[model samples]
Target: MFILDIFSLQQNIDFSLRSLTISLLLGTLLSLALKIHYQRFGMSLSNRVAFSKVFVFITLTTTLIISIVKSSIALSLGLVGALSIVRFRTPIKEPEELAYLFMCIAVGLGLGANQWLATIVATTIILIVTIRWKRSEDQSLFLSLDWEKSHNIDLDQLQNCLLKFICDCDLRRFDSRDEREEVIYYINIANSDNLLSLIQKLKTDFPQIGISFLDKTTIPGV
Candidate 1:
């Protein structure tokens, strides 16, 4: 009877290679779509192009691992143990990036469980909603300025310059030192053309000024 029980357990643990292969392929394609979506619509100020490169790999690997572990309770437990030892040090700077990663994992889990149709439909719907939400939200930008103290530029002069193209400008921070000065502002402009014009005007008037625009959702940085 023990021998027969062991044979049944072994048979239960055996999974179809064709199903695993199909799941992996689907995962790869979905991950690619996610990568493209993030690169285009994502609001993260980090190096998004470099960060998004991991989507495909993360999805495919998750699919493969889930497919293997789903066949047996012992394997699933072992997987949990193995994953607990792994450490990821790279920081995720924004909540948006973390949300995308969760989406990738969810896609892999659904496909790995052989719920392909449901996964595809749900992902499509979510991506569409994300696009609409982003479009409707107010987009504010953070502007950073740095220049040498030798330029003799003052805060009032900078505000005067900003008022020409920007209808609204709020000073966020100001730092001054022996030789260098830094200023941060929260500003709203209509379009890319306005941004370019502002940058050009700043450069023309104060050649030594350094300008950087950062996404308002993130910490203001160069």
Candidate 2:
């Protein structure tokens, strides 16, 4: 009697040149489109060019992960465990940024699964809706920050924080003495809730500092 094994352990990994190439190409193009859409229509207080990389990186990594895991159930489980252990401590200041990141991940998931057509179509629809929505609601808001500096003050960090929560922040004034300095910033933002929230968050983060926003139009001195 000849004994034959019907179920064998196959460890070999195979890549289809055509499918891999098409998926990656689609992912790259879709990510680029998302980056552009975000830069042009993003309503966040900070729209730094450096942030665009988040979309590109997330999309490509997702694509790679999905592609690699598709061939092995073992690898897919490993990915889940690895991701579960990782935690991000940094706060996401803008909801829109988080939404975009999620969209990028979705694109990556589709492409990695070799669903190129659906990824492309979905991306297009999302971009159109986001742009039009932003256009429909157009208003300008601004914030002003003034503080008498202390020895513990971090000038660069303060500026960066302002940029992160406001559309544009300019250093209108700065006066320094032996042990202290006075600083002023004029910020452009569009949401009253966000403005109040930012002020409260800043107060909580830096209790020693003075932070407030005033009505620019009512202020007499320019």
- The best candidate by TM-score is 1
Worst 10 residues of 1 by lDDT: 188-197
Minimum summed lDDT over a 10-residue window in model 2 is located at: 1-10
Per-residue CA lDDT of model 1 for 1-222, tens digit only, reads: 999988887888968799999999999888999998897677654577898998998898888888888889988998989999999898877788899999999999998888999999999999999988865554478889999888888789888998798757999999999999999999876544456689899999888999999876555453
Error of 2 at 136 (Å): 0.6
Error of 1 at 20 (Å): 1.7
Best by lDDT: 1
* Pairs of residues clashing in candidate 1: none
- lDDT per model, in order? 0.85, 0.74
Q: Estimate each model's TM-score.
A: 0.73, 0.60
